[model samples]
Target chain A: MIRFEEVNFAYGARSVLRSVSLSVGFHERVAVLGGSGEGKTTILKLILGLIRPDTGSIIIDGDDITRRSESELRETRMKFSIVFQEGALFDSLDVKENVAFCLREYTDMSEDEINARVRHILASVGVEQALELMPEELSGGMHRRVSIARSLALDTPRMFLYDEPTTGLDPVNADNICGLIAELSKNGKGFIMVTHKVSDALKVADRFIFLRNGSLLFDGNRHELLNSDHPDIMIFINEVCIQGPSGA
Target chain B: MDVKRTISDLQDFYSLSLHGLLGIAGRPFYFKDALLQMDYAGAGSVVIVVIVDLFVGMALSLQLAAELSSLGLKMYIGMIVGISVVRELGPVVTALVFTGRVGAGMASELGSMALGHQVDTIRVFGLDPVKKLVTPRIVSSLIMLPALTVIGVAVSLLGGYYIAVFVSHQSGTVYWTSIRNILTVENVLAGASKPFIFAYLISSICCYMGLSTRGGSVGLRQATTRAVVMSIVMIIVADFVLTRMLLYVLGFSV
Candidate 1:
């Protein structure tokens, strides 16, 4: 489980998260929905212990990481993995090396074992053909798939954090990624995704979190979101409707 | 430059450099990465060092012979060139060139990694960026710079030899003997120590700049430029300071 208690964050005077508090159960599938620069990414980073809250505490897997040293945080981070917005693949490494990185670092697996494991993970993610290709050679969707494969390299990580995973891609690729997330969600592990794409979020996550101006405005399932009377929530739904009619 | 910012940067640089040095004692040392960096910093740099130092030695010999022949001291050309190149020019020029080649490359590569989120990815995988990236670079620079300086000194002596024995018509035996006689223990120590210091300064400065990169490509370009400029300036300044301190400590007449 992960818990944020009255967490506040700022970027040198410009507050991003303001007295925000939330929690995620071990097997929960959550989508944090917000506009651009509404501190969505900041929330994901905080969960990963990538950045600390200015005030209050964050507890991950029952351990408070608020003031933990970087070395300590490294141990905590082993419980989770993050896929950045752009896939954030190591440009210098080929897809195989990137996917095999964590396994090689933390596990005593033999070379053949590591290769087999990488191949299995890549096959699971449907990017097995990209094993020898560099990051630049992969398509946008393929890059994100490879990123997901890399994240799944570690057997111990129980939660996955996705930061705008489908932000920049064509409709077909976006749908493919949404489908991938849906497929991964069935594994019974926690997932926390921050994205502006409401339709895609509605497709995969059972719980939705709405952030407006750095504070949670709504937190519930699809029924509550569709039936919400909050003016801002209604405005957001209407705007998405006006932009394009979504099935969700 | 803002004085406060400059001081703050220095403090950060010192802290990071100290952390990098201490990392040598930590667990999970990346020996393979260090060896790869050594190849990049040492073997990749030999040809350039040899060529540059050769020209510099030849130029120094030409000027020194012209001036010394008038004073009937042309045979002393090897001594002057040897002492100057071994104690000062070889290390300084090598460090400056390294700052341009390897140091700038370090900053840009790391800057791109920082921007691309690869550094953060390393952290997420339970790895220390300092240990994984900066330490190997610092270690490689520490080992390679001094080795290159030795090579530079030897090639420089050969350059001086060619000018002294062939161009200036001095006896090859006299020139070689003069170099052998002038390079005392103190002079060798002075020459040997400067490369280590310059290597530390260059690697740390470049690594700090690379990891601190912000914005985007513009920020990366600025960081790379700043790293090269700062390292070059620091090398020259450190060379002067080390020369003066080594002279006094080694009991050489100032």
Candidate 2:
């Protein structure tokens, strides 16, 4: 489980997250929805220990991680994998090498075993043919898929973090990615996906979290989220309703 | 520049350099990466170092020989050119050139990685970016810069030989003998030591700049420029301090 207690964060003088408190279960599928600069992504970065909270405690599996050193944070980070907004694939590495990187570094798997695992992971993400292709050759959707494959390469992570995974894709591709995320969320694998798109979030997440102006506006199931008369939630839902599901 | 910010940055740069130095003896050594970087920092630099030093040597010989011949000391051309190149010019020039090429490349590459979140990704994978990226670079620069300086000195002497024997009409044997005689232990040691320090400063500063990059392309440009400019300035400054310190250590007067 991951929990953030009264977490606050700022970049220089500009506050990005303010006194936010939340908890996520080991098998929960959650989507954190917010518009641009609403601190949705900051939550993911904080949880990953890439950045620390200005105040408050972030506990992973009951261990407070706010004061952990970087080398120490590596242990906490190993429990989760993240897909960055821009894919963030190593440009110099081919798809196969990118997926195999963690395994090669952390595991003592033989070459054949590593190759087989890489192929299986890539195939699971529907990009098996891209094994030899560099990141520059991939489309935005394919790049995200490859990034997902790389993240999934390590089997030990209990949760996954997705940052605006479908923000830039075309409507059809976005739908396909949403479908992929939903499919991957099965078998008790939990994920916290942060995005600005309500439609995409609804497809993959059973629980919805609304962040607005650097604070938690709402956190509940789909039914509570849909029925809530909260002005910001209503505005987000109304925008999605008027613009249709893609919200593109 | 804000004084506090500058001081903070220096502190961070020193910390990073120390971390990279310690990583050299740590486990999971990236020998292949270091070898590749050596190829990039060393072998790739040969032609440029040779070309630039060759011209510098030729010009120094032409001017020094002309002045010396007027006083019947033209035969000492090799001693002057050799000692100057070996003791001062070669290492400083090579380090400045290296800062422009290798240091700038390191900053841009790592800056792009930071912007792309690749560094964070490495951290997420339980790997240290300083160990994986900075250590190999520091090792390569530490080894390659000195080797390149030696090459620089050799070509410079060759260029001086061309000017002294061909243009100035000095005896080739006398010029060679003079060069051979003047390269004392202290002179060679002083010249050879500067590149190692310059290499460490260049690699560490550039890596730090690259990893600290923020914003976007504009930030990358700023970091790259800072890496090159700061490296060059530091190299020049270090050269002066090192020369003086080495002379003192070697029991030289003044």
What are the clash counts of all predictions, listed in order? 0, 0
After superposing candidate 2, which stretches have Cα over 4 Å from the reference? A243-248, B1-4
Which is the leading candidate under DockQ?
A: 2
**Candidate 1 ranges with C-alpha deviation above 4 Å:** A239-247, B1-11
Residue A13 lDDT, candidate 1, scale 0-100: 81
Tens digits of per-residue lDDT for model 1, B125-243? 98999999999999999999999999998998999999998999999999889899978999999999999999999999999999999999999999999999999999989998999
Here, model 1's chain A TM-score works out at 0.95
Error of 1 at A133 (Å): 1.0
lDDT of 2 by residue, A7-28 (tens): 9999988999999999999799
Worst 10 residues of 1 chain B by lDDT: B93-102
